[model samples]
Target: MAEVKASMAGNVWKLMVSEGDSVDASQDVVILESMKMEIPIAAEVSGTVKELKVKEEDFVNEGDVIAVVE
Candidate 1:
C-alpha cells in the first residue's frame, strides 16, 4: 500500500479521487490550499484508492497521511 502524504500543512480544498478509483502515477488526487495558494497532491504510484484519510475542507499537517492506495 502507498500512503499519500501532505507535502505541507494546509486545508484540504478538494478530493479529486474517491475510494476505489483507479489512478496512475503522478495523478493529482487532492487539492490543498495553503498560503493563499492551491496545491495539488499527486499519487506516486498507479493503483486503486483504498482509503481517504481527509475530507474536503479538513485541516492537514505536513507529513499527514491523506490517503492510502493499493
Candidate 2:
C-alpha cells in the first residue's frame, strides 16, 4: 500500500479520484488551495485507490495523508 500525502498546508480544493479507482504513478489525486494557488497532489505509485483520508474543503498540513492506494 502507498499513502498519498499533501505537499503543503492548504484546503483540499478537489478530489480527482474516488475509492476503488485505478490510477497511475504521478496521477493527480487531489488539488489543494493555498496562497491563491492550486496545488495538485499526485499518487506516488500506480494502484487502485483504497481510501480517501480527506474531503473537499478539508484543511491539511504539509505531509498529511490524503489517500491510500493498494
* lDDT of candidate 2 over 1-70, digit per residue (tens): 9999999999999999999999999999999999999999999999999999999999999999999999
How far residue 41's Cα lies from its native spot in candidate 2, in Å, is: 0.4
lDDT of each: 0.98, 0.98
Point out the worst 10-residue segment of candidate 1 by lDDT.
61-70
Candidate 2 is scored at a TM of 0.98
Q: Please write out the lDDT profile of model 1 over residues 22-54, one tens digit for every residue.
A: 999999999999999999999999999999999
lDDT of 1 at 35: 96
Which residue segments of model 2 deviate by more than 4 Å? none
Model 2: weakest 10-residue lDDT segment is 1-10
Clashing pairs in 1: none
Which residue pairs show collisions in model 2?
Answer: none
lDDT score of model 1?
0.98
